[model samples]
Target: MTRLHTLFLIGMLALLISTPTFALTGRVINQTLNRPEPDIEVSYILHETGDVTVVRDTTDSKGQFILDVPSDPGAEPPPMLFARYNGIDYPGNPAPAGDTVDIPVFETTESDTAISLSSHHILLDAQAGTATYIFIVHNHGDHTYLTGGDHGHGLEIPLPDGVTDFIRAPQGVHLHGTLLVDPRPIIPGNSQTFFTFSIPPSNRIAQRITYPTAGMDLLVQPTDTPVSTTVLRDLGDVTLGTNVFRRFGAEQLAPGTQIDIALSSPETASNLQTPIWIAATSMVVVAILVIYMRTLKTVPNRRTILLEQIADLDERYESGELSEDDYKNRRNALKAEVIDLSDSN
Candidate 1:
């Protein structure tokens, strides 16, 4: 080939090599119960340490998704791309038991791996008073840090429908003191954050609170799971009553009156039961002492003679006048005398 032709060929080759290449593209669809869950945010993560380059995506109206990720130029083989749809940690429940996708290992090459996540919902409705109900959100998963800032994991709870004119405590953030939402990032293994707040009384029936929609990318080990904890109340409930600054307690609660009571930890529970137990124990000891004192009157009062006999036995034994066996016999005789004197009562 001529030199000019060769140069033109080289330029064409460089252009082809420099062109941007797409790593992988796909969408995360929630196929649970043959339906799609919108508003479920997706995240792309690095498996180790859950350090992630987050790409937030929302499902279409039909639950379809398409992601365009660029190839990593520095990677030798390029890292794999996984789709974490909604909360399902895997993709395509194709198996009979809903098999999830395996999170791929990091590499220098582009890999098309899809991740799916799932969730279960339960309904809990209860009444609250002026006191805030604190929920300490402990992030047991990876990325163990409180991202909720100063408010902690605050969730803005809207007043129930058709209900208003209620008192609010810590009202600046939202209608409710939202900083106490659960599942706040704790050290995946050893650390956690504490959150507390008071829940105000609301007459509304359709109250809503803004809760956390996503969590940190922490690898949950085989033994890792959510552990429930009992809430320990540091103070008794303050109730409005006729007496000044007085309220009814467990001991004085009236029949059929409703009250809020929190479960105590083992140590606190033991302390609570101690007072009654000690009182009963003292009564038992007193009863035993009284019985022993009553039995004393039935014994004879021969103190004078008993002391004389015991003194004589001790003298003989100490003087080396009594053999081992003889000393024992004399001691027994003296003991019998003392017993007989008591019977004379």
Candidate 2:
């Protein structure tokens, strides 16, 4: 053979050896419209360190892409791939090398169906003059419910006449007087809120919540879901079945109908009247004392002192005494003590 021909064969072999063997192949589809989505951006994210690497090509006309991602030996957990659609990221299953991944996307539209209440739990704390209500709101429609503008007013929940101190609302929801309004849209699926308010002590506390639509499933205590630790005591007319306290309505509620729940807290029970700030400070002090006592019993040393300082730093950061950058730097320095102690041992 000629020398030029031999050289060409050697270069071809080098090119073949350098090319990566594994690849990630995937297709993006609009599940709501039942069609392939073309020219959409897809991302591959490393699981452990949250490092993101983008694919070069968008989906083709057939909504398919093949990405030649070289396998990384340093990546602790295998990376994952997901597609972004309509300002939301839909994640796919853990994609190893040479796997076909398909991502489904949905379109958001305005929904007309009434929101359903899947669960309602009332915890009456007579001792603290507070009654905490938890409502599990579910949207069983194809579209999301937008609260403002032409979408109409959001869900209305009536509070007790003397109710005060609305404790919490869902993240995007706005609280005005007794009404809990969603400032943003309530997306499809299930969303919940734990709202506590102060009420006068009474033998029978009448709690009424008005909904925009009718169908709802009321439960005194969650059956399968482990939500809160507060338990309802002094059951009046409500019947208990097994471990669950459920009240299933036979008919869809009329639009204006008010669902009333009666709760009775024992006379011996005291209301939770202490301010939150006072309670939080007391808990922090108790935790610090307990940790200090334990450290003293365990034998004081540099390692123990470093751990205590780390805990104190975390508490100060949470209480707004330390800035984020300072807290992170100090905490990282303290964690280095772990390595020193390990070496000494």
Please report the TM-score between candidate 2 and the true structure. Answer: 0.48
Error (Å) of candidate 2 at residue 166 is 2.0
- Candidate 2 local accuracy as lDDT? 0.52
Against the hidden true structure, what lDDT does model 1 obtain? 0.29
For each predicted model, how many residue pairs clash, with residues at least 3 apart or on different chains? 25, 6
Question: 1-345 in candidate 2: lDDT tens per residue?
Answer: 999999999999998888354577889988667888888777764422223344544788988977776566344333446666665445555366767788766676555364776545554443344455655556666555554532245655666655544654433445577665553344455544455665554434444545543334334333322222212323223332112343333234444554444444333324354577335323333343334235324222233344455666666789998778777766665566446544433
TM-score of each: 0.21, 0.48
Q: Put down candidate 1 lDDT per residue, 221-310, tens digits, no spaces.
A: 111222121121122222111111111111221222222322121111223225664443233222322232233221111222233344
Off by over 4 Å in 2: 1-25, 39-83, 89-102, 112-114, 123-129, 148-156, 200-257, 261-345
Which structure among the candidates has the greatest TM-score?
2
Error of 2 at 280 (Å): 9.8
Best candidate according to lDDT: 2
Task: Go through the candidates in order and give each one's C-alpha lDDT.
Answer: 0.29, 0.52
- Candidate 1 runs further than 4 Å off: 1-11, 14-16, 31-33, 36-62, 66-68, 73-345
